[model samples]
Target: MSDTESNSSNRQTGIATALQHPQPFEESTIFDEYREIMTRSHEQQRQIYSEFKAFTDDVASWVKAASQFDNFRSRKRIKTRLEWIKAKHGEIEGVRREVVTCVEAVRAALSMLGGITRSLKGFSGIVKDEFDGGNDSDLQEPRSVDCAGPNQACAK
Candidate 1:
């Protein structure tokens, strides 16, 4: 096969593999295999968040150190330091963006899980309510998160 055709074939294979193993959605079975996958994803996402936070903390420290470098120096060294500092800041910013994206994806999965859980609860509620004819309070008010400042405290 020609180089182009070979590349195309490789791309097709990659696409096929990606579609074959797409991210897991919530399953109905009690022993859902995908639950483990979801849990792993959650853990991986949390790790990314932790790493991003550490990167941000390091950037904060670097910025504090840079602020102390007010003494006049050679133009070359000054330019090099400025460039290095900017690059570090940019790297931290990129990680922050990745963290946001990863967090949002994990949050979306959690939301889907929440929906499935609620549906299951509703079904169980109907069955329980039928047997005892009792009112159900499983559906409570949604908790609100305060994402205003650095610390996100969930409002009760």
Candidate 2:
């Protein structure tokens, strides 16, 4: 067979295979799976928040200790310590912003999913209510950030 004919034959075979073995999850099942994934993500975020909090606390303690020393050695140590503290503070800030962004994204996604669910359920009042006074200002705008600059680590 020619190259074009061979390519068409392969495409037809692929389509036939895909049709024979359809996706296992229905629309509702897919939504449930997504919700489960989000739940796990939330748990991971909580752990990250705790870890970062502890790290920030440790940095704060070091800063406090560095403040009490007056010797030349302490002065030298303080310089490096301050730099470390500053870096950590930046990391903390980045994580904070990331958490905020993730929360907003999740909220938006949930809102969309809620709409889909309502539509699927044949609820007519939801759309009207959403437009009337049920809308939240916080969900209206998503916060954005630039993590490509120097010293900017994109928080996962």
Query: Given candidate 1, what's the lDDT at residue 69?
Result: 64
Query: What overall lDDT goes with each candidate model?
Result: 0.65, 0.70
Each prediction's TM-score versus the true structure: 0.28, 0.36
State how far residue 148 of model 1 sits from its true place (Å).
22
| lDDT over C-alpha atoms for residue 85 of model 2 | 100
lDDT of 1: 0.65
* Best-performing candidate as measured by TM-score: 2
- Candidate 1 residue-wise lDDT, 8-118, digit = tens: 999999999999999775556644667878999999999999999999999999987776664434666889999999999999999999977876776567655443222
lDDT of 2 at 31: 93
- Model 2: per-residue Cα lDDT at residue 83: 96
Question: Where does the lowest 10-residue lDDT sum fall in candidate 2?
Answer: 120-129
